[model samples]
Target chain A: METQKTHILRRLFFSTLYLSAFTFGGGYVIVTLLKNRFVDQYHWIDEDEMLDLVAIAQSAPGAIAVNGAIVVGYKLAGLTGVAVSVLGAVIPPMAILTVVSYCYDAFSTNPYIAAMLGGMRAGVGAVITSVVYDMGKNVVRAGDPVNVVIMILSFCISYFLNVNVVFIIIAVAVFGALRSVAAQKAGERS
Target chain B: MICLRLFLSFMQIGCFCFGGGYAAMPLIEEQVVTANHWLTMNAFSDLVTIAEMTPGPIAINAATFVGTQVAGPAGAVAATCGYIFPSCLFVTLLAYVYTRFRNLSLIQQTLASLRPAVVALIAKAGIGILIAAFFVNGTFSLAAGNVSFRMILYFAAALVLLRKAKLNPILVMVLCGAAEVIFYCAGTLIR
Candidate 1:
């Protein structure tokens, strides 16, 4: 059992490090890649578990990718798992960005870097679109019209009106809590 | 003292930022750019661009860059730890409660409703990034001289490869970057 625990920690660390190093764009994109690796490849987490972790990660404060990593890590191997996972998730960004900081002036002026980034940005946009679609399909397929409505309203509020996201999250969360209470009462009555 | 302030301010940003990393942008902008004046608006924008181009969470990258700029490597570590501290603490607590109470109806219903909202936020964020990438000067300009059609083509190709071919994301990004370099080099040759 002791050896097994250490082995799990090592595996979790390396996998997360690999994921964090390669993933570009946003947290949602990393979530997708993680599903492929952890769920599909490693069997460390199943589909529904992965989905739940992601939802929690999104709703929680801080970076979704790291939040997801920590939760999944904790589930797999407890506190040690969380520590290793966070370290793995963090090291790549800190190390790479710190190096980039040293050559910041040269990087900003390089035309080749500029061109590469331009294409990558557009590609990143498209990748994000794919993530949104996959996530939306899961939500919409659950057959909740209220959820569908909230999804549309949230988009309209944020995209068109430029509302602060914190307000949107608070409003949605309040609605969710209220709906839960209402459902509880209805269930008791029935 | 500056390091202490940096850590505390980032902790505040970390606590309130929801809907994922991109959503943290405005909060980081408010704290670093407006409140602290650590970086100017132009520099912040550049930081975002660089953050996007690099791997890892944009917020983490921003924290590192801003922290490094303000103090040094130590500042970077302090700011990052401060930023992620809430997440580490809260998520661990949540995992404990959620696993135990997952079957409770109230918890179930709340998660059900929250799922769609999370999806919406992701969609909205994606569209925002897309608009930033594809639009220029508040206009949807796709002209050859203005926005690079090659980039759009690259975007379309990437989408196809990802969805149809099921290519790895890292590979897709590399291919896009390589294609852009080739295209730019060719353009220069022709000119």
Candidate 2:
């Protein structure tokens, strides 16, 4: 039984480690990679649970990638799993950045590097736009008036009004709770 | 003392950086670029490119890069830990209670509401990044000029590759980066 636990822990760590080390473009890419590995490859989490985990991760504070790892890790092997998975997700980036930081001056001044970065920035921008489109399709329901309003309002406030995101989150959470209560009350009446 | 300060500042960022890494960009920009003066705006932009090109979360990568820029390796460790500290704590607590309260209607509704908001936040972040990348003058209006046609071309090409051809992100990045180098080197020679 103990051996089984250890084996799972090792697998969790290596898988996360592998994902973090190789995957670039960040955020949703990592989530998709995790889904492919855990849900499709390992069969650790099912399709439905993976979706729920992503939703929870998306709503929670911190990086979605880290949050996803935490949720899946906990589901698979409790606290220990969480620890190993977080470590796996974090270490590779930390190590890579540490090295890059050490040579930043060199990276900054090199014309070739500058051009490469210039191009990479555009590519990265495209990737981010793609994430927004993919996520917006799922999250924005034209059929659901409330969701549509919140989505549009949130974007306008953030982009146009330049409102602080913390305030927006607080307002939305309060609205959500109230909406929930109203929904339940309406259901009870029927 | 610097390490402690780094830890505290990043911990605050970690706590408040809701929605995810991209959404955290503005907050991070305010803290590191404007408030702390740890890095100039140009440097911060460069770091973002580096963060995207490299593996890991953008927030984590930013924390490490900014910390290292401000201090050193110890600073990197301090900042990285501080950034993730909230996540480790919150996710654990939430994970425990969430399993038991998974059926709670309030929780479900809260999540439902938050999802659209998260989408908006990500969209805002995406636009912010796009403006930063494509608009060389730092203004949203193209009439202000300084628009980089090359950047736009690259962006369109990459978007097409990803959306139409369904190419891998890594491949797109590599191809674009290489194309830029070749273009720039060739331009210099022709000039």
Candidate 3:
């Protein structure tokens, strides 16, 4: 049991490390990659569980990637898992920045680096669109009209209205909580 | 003392940075550039470019870079730990609560509702990045002149490869970068 636990921790560390090291375009992209790895590849977590983890990560303060690593880590092992995963997630950025700091001008001014980044951003955008499609499909699969409406409204409000995401999340969370309470009461009455 | 200051400053940014991603940029600019005077606006812009190009959250990259500029490697560690500390505490606590109460109907319903909203948020973020990727100067314009054909090709090709070929996303990203380098070299040769 002890060895097995250690092995799982090691795997968790390296998985997050590799994901963090390669994932570009920030939190959403990394979260999408995490879902792919954990749900599709490793099968450690189910689709529903991954969605819940993402919601929590998004609603939380700080980098969603770090918050994501923490929750996924906790789910897999516990607090110790959280520590290892967070360490792995952070190591790449710190190491890269440390090196970049030493040669700031050369690193930042290089046209080749800029061109590569431009292309990667395009690729990153594609990956994010795929994530939206997959996650949106799951929401639509539930056949909840209200949820479908909410999804559409949420997208329009955020994308078109340019509202702060924190407010949107808070609004949806309250509506969800109130909905759950109402359903509970209705069930009791029935 | 400087390390302590860096830790505290980043801790404050971490505590207040909700929604992550670009949301933290203004707060960071205010703290590191405006209040602390750690970096000039020009240097901070460079930092932003570096953060965007690099493979981590902008907040983490910013913390590490600013910390390194202010002090050294120790400063980087201190600032990073401070930045991530709140996330660790909050996520661990939330995860514990979530796992413990997952079977509860209220938790389940709330999660069910949250699922759609989260998807919307992801969609919105994706569109924002897509515009940034496909348009010139990261602005949306209908003009053909404003469209970046090369970036559009990269986007379309990547989407096809990911959805059809099921290629590893990291590998796709590297391929796009390599393709861009080749294109750049070819363009220079033609000129």
Candidate 4:
């Protein structure tokens, strides 16, 4: 068990640090890559579990990487995994960026960087879109048409209606909870 | 005083940031643009734009950018560390407790309940970004819109490439960046 703990933490650290190093756009993009690596490549927890990790991480009060470290760690090695993973993710990015800090004044307004960023920004958005669609495949399953409708509605509310995240989350939680309760009662009845 | 204030303010942002950096933008707008009066909406928007292009959370990038702009290297360090401290502290402690409570049924039940709600938030957040990224005049239309056609094309193309091809995102971004610069120059020369 102890040897297993070391291996898991080691793998998580390297994976997250790689993400921190390469991820240029945002944390959401990192999450996508993470889902690919941990879920697709390693089969760490499968796709649904990975989506759940992202969801919980998103709703929690912290940086995305930190939340991921915690949740993935817990899933893998209880608490120790979370500790090492979060530390791994946070330290490298922070350190490297601080070094890059020395160049901010010189390079911040560079025309080339600015031009490249314009395209990269749009690409990041696209990546997010693709990731959401990928995640939706599982979250919105064929067994339930409600998941599909809820997803579409939520998307509209967020995009067009501009609803608060807290409100949307509360609505879904209440609905899912009620459904679970209803299912339990029906189970008892039968 | 200014440096100290920026440090503390960023710490607040970092501590309370749920989701990712983009999700924290509204609050950041409130604190930096509205409350502190350090920057206008335009400046904040520019900062966000630059932060998005960089390699970390916008919150961290904001701290580094603003800190450097406000003071210097020390300010940057102060603000970045302040922003990160809360999560580091929280995760370390939570991991410790979680290690001890791995098999607890109540915790399992609570986590299960929380998962779907999380999906809603993720979906909602995606919509919000999509709307902001694409919508114009309270309606979303890719045709005959004021929004940049290049951006939309990149978005659509990248989505297809990502889903279909086994290409690296970094490589895609690099190729797209080169194309954008070429197109930008061509547009400028034509105009």
Candidate 3 achieves a global lDDT of: 0.81
Q: Judging by DockQ against the true structure, name the best candidate.
A: 2
True contacts kept of 3: 0.78
Task: Please state the error at residue A65 of candidate 1 in Å.
Answer: 5.1
The DockQ scores of all candidates, in the order shown, are 0.48, 0.58, 0.45, 0.28
Q: Which pairs of residues have clashing backbones in candidate 3?
A: none
Candidate 4 per-residue lDDT, tens place, B71-124, comes to: 777777677767766766665555455456533333333334444344544554
| True-vs-predicted CA distance for residue B37, candidate 4, Å | 8.3
Query: Across residues B81-123, which tens digit of lDDT does each residue of candidate 2 receive?
Result: 8988988888777767667776445666776787688678777
**Model 4, stretches more than 4 Å misplaced?**
A1-64, A67-88, A99-109, A142-157, A166-190, B1-97, B104-145, B187-191
Q: Can you list the residue pairs that collide in candidate 1?
A: none
lDDT of candidate 3 over A1-190, digit per residue (tens): 9999999899999999999999887798889988998899989999999998987786567898999999899999998999999999999999999999988757547878667766777777777678678878987888999899988998898777767655666688789889999999999999
Tell me, what's the RMSD of every candidate? 5.1, 3.4, 6.6, 6.9
Interface RMSD of each: 3.8, 2.7, 5.1, 5.3
Clashing pairs in 2: none
**In model 2, which regions exceed 4 Å deviation?**
A1-8, A25-59, A72-78, A137-142, B17-21, B99-101, B137-145
Q: Indicate the TM-score of model 4.
A: 0.60
